[model samples]
Target chain A: MNHYIDVRTQIPRARQTINNNNIKTETEGGVPEWAIIELQGLIQMKKEDQSGPTVVGDLHYFSRNRHPVLILGHHVLNGKEVKLEQPMAVIEKDDTTSYKVKAIVKKKLLFKSRPKPIISNVSEKV
Target chain B: MDTCPERSSEDVRKIIKTAKLHESELTEVTQILRFPDPSKQNDNLKLMLLDDNLLKEIEGGNQLIFKGDPDENAVLCTSSKTYDIKEAETSNSLLLVPELLFAASTGLDETIVNKSVEGDSDSSFDKSNTSLNKSADSDDGKPPREIVHKDIISTFFTYYELKPCKPRLSKLIKLLDPTKYRGPELEYAVDKSKLYNYEALFDQIQASKAELDEELIKIQAIKIDDHYRLLEFDYEFRVLSHMLDLIEENSWPLDRISKDVTIDSLKDLVPESILEAMFGFYSSESAVDDGIQYYQYKQDKVCQFLARVLLKSAGKFNLTEFLQAWRDSVPEGMTTDESLLSGIALIDKTTTPQVVWGFAESDLPEDINQRFKVLFQTKAKWTVDEISPYIQLYATEKLNVNALLTKYARASTQDGVRVFSAKHMK
Candidate 1:
């Protein structure tokens, strides 16, 4: 319980290794690479399928749109790129000295809207 | 395709140059998101969610730490504040995509590859061949080269949320009890553990650095030979009395007491460092003259110390006798108010002699329920204002003093004044 959540060494180093990350412009840079795909309900799958490499969905990014679209099986759900109101620090407690910040996630890929069914309407050639 | 990238948060991308439709630039990239292999899905990653204010402090480069005992729930600490760390569970899967591309990171540059291949995602199928990419034309109508794939390294279903709370500092007193500095002369007599320095105390005490520093000041703890040492009660009272005597001997007005003057006079009597810190405790800075800042001996602080000194010696005294003695003990021209005794001493009229006894708040448990038990044990009943200081430390945004009283103590009007007594009185 007497532990430290060390961010001093991690956060300052993350700033220089920036990959298109811009936080508050004046404050600091963004965290590179990491994001959370926060689904509304549980991404429940069958027990048998859970053991294998399961396909969650396909994320489609379109130019000029604020949010992206995700295709899961027969369902097409629009996902928004949102900054989490309270940013979270991903902590990894290794079996030794202290807890370290693995990554800090500022923005998330939010898939909250009701999924629209991808109804195929292609006309068959005779 | 088998590599897990150079960095932990790397976003690996791959592109397929499928046949292109002329004139329409289909820059859209469809990425297949999948779960990692079941063996790789370890719930080792925990998110310590930060509030906006605390987030700002973190960004400002403050150290965040957590402290607790084995059975107690751990508390997190920033430089200035402490917070209760509560694990919140989410029904939805928190797909921790360390390299998931945000809207801003996915443009112009080829830092990311063709989006069909998920870098950390599951390799159950050939992602490049299943080109959901029907059209493959750049803005220049050129077919792009290749594709890439990546897997999610980890995922989590719960996160640690923080709520600001009073620093749990009662343990500090317990830790320092054995190592009390009874002056340099008596240091060899008692067997003690290797003394706790600031760093050691910080590691042991369940409080933030700034909060802990303030508590040390309030506890009047002084540094002797780099170790934060609490002065023994008798020794501390001796020092306090000497400091008071120096003020009277020099004929210096309370407002004009100089650090240089106190240091020069008390150097042989008390260590200079102890003298300086004690002055800081009993006084507040008023103004600077000739580059020497003067401190007015704080009236309330001095009076409280003197009252504690009187209350401790007598253990318990008839209310009238204790009041007179307390008044006589303080420096002349300074007055003592009963309100100053809020957390220091309690005057009980229920007793036959109506005695006033020392009851320092620092000795009580930091817990809400346990503290109420001790309060009720000390005296059967307490008026609202009398017990507020003792209980007020636990008051948070969701639970204020009145609300806490409602839950823990039964209330009734005693002689037109609201009084609180333990709910299940023994």
Candidate 2:
């Protein structure tokens, strides 16, 4: 059977474990601190008769306390971007050293490109 | 007989003074004897002095008597001697024995007593007289009023005089009494035929009530439906009328006649396809002596065909609501390709109306027309990859893509496509 890895769950778990002790740092002075964690997860897509597993996508992560955080790069990765069927999260053990992820894998479908939002001219004050 | 004729004056004076002293002592004794209890002494004295009975007792004494008739003569006997009595008499010849003196004094006392008795009788008579006078004063020609002992008594008498005496429950007893002829004869006569048809009358009333209720319910439902329909129609009419008006004014030809048979004249003709595409764009562009008119003419033709094809689709949906939303999305002074695209996207998201995609250039806003022209050229080559981003942007921003698509598609075929050829192709 083919086993699928939930990229959303793996990304947050890796970030949480890395930022457990280290304080967030910022690139510019006077700017609020932000935490960035690069997560790489190997998602496998196995065929029914194939003996080996095929990698689907890699997971990348970055976060800030406030502001719009970009989760995925604009470019496609291997003909696909890391997308999840459902929102997922990582669960940490009481000892805080290890992590376990919980996720659901639903039926996969072709991903449509996110449309570029049009910028409309703001209407003049009447 | 009377040998010793008279005593000396000095001896008579001495005798009178001694007798007077005895009389005072006897008077004191009589007062004491009258009442043994000293507390009642005043009462006893008043009785002896003032009472006629005491005087009468004194009159019965042997020393006092009437000489002739009792009623005519008043005399006193003194030691068996008689002396006349008068109102004013002062004479030594009237001297008498001490017992006779006391008795003669009693005679005067009796007269005083009799006068006192008469005075009392007069006083009592005055009291009775005053009472009688009061009774006579109270009589004012009206009947004597009797005091009522109880309020019920007065009320009963008043009710008796004012109204006929009858039992309070007479009517009720008459209604229930078996002795009285309280059967149908005494009751209001009901028609037997009407009573026999009671069930039919009841059925008729029930049927009428049911019909009334149903009619009321229908009226209420119709009122509500009409209210919503009016609102919907109002919005529909506003948008549809506005679109038609704008198209007719800006898009249609003003010339009444086609002057020349030229390629330019062909351009002036409105495309039938575009006309039939939607109800709102029918009069947008006018036929003119220009190449754009040919596109308009062709568009009219295409629109006509689309109208037939989409009649069922439009019927199933509220085209009025869709048009209103489309018109509202296109803001004022936003006569641009991007604006039109945004309006189309809005309509698509809200109304989800089906449309064909392309571009056009006419006597519309210059920048938007040019953009459409550019996009049309690119779309002709089926290079959607280059235009997909713009389309995506238009879609995401909720522009009226349907209008843009129809307008642009007509503009691209304006040069070569003929209405007759397009009709055959469809």
Task: Please give the fraction of native interface contacts (Cα pairs under 8 Å between A and B) kept by each candidate.
Answer: 0.42, 0.00
Candidate closest to the true structure, highest lDDT: 1
lDDT of each: 0.67, 0.24
What lDDT does candidate 2 reach at residue B321? 46
B1-426, model 2: which lDDT tens digit per residue? 011122232332222122221111111111000001223212100000102321222222211111222223222222222223222211111100011111122223344346448763322323333544243332333132211110000000000001111111112222222222112233254223222122222122212223323432322111121110011222223333343344344543423212222222222332222123223222234454445332222333223222322232332434454344434433233222323332122112233564323222221233544555554433343223233334332332234544444444432333464211111111
Q: On a 0 to 1 TM-score scale, where does candidate 2 land against the true structure?
A: 0.11
TM-score of each: 0.73, 0.11
Provide the fnat value for model 1, as a fraction from 0 to 1.
Answer: 0.42
Error at B277, model 2, angstroms = 32
lDDT of 1 by residue, B111-193 (tens): 22433344622111243234345322122232332222345666666778788887888777887878888877898975656
TM-score of chain B of 1: 0.77
Residue range with the least summed lDDT across 10 consecutive positions in model 1 chain B: B14-23
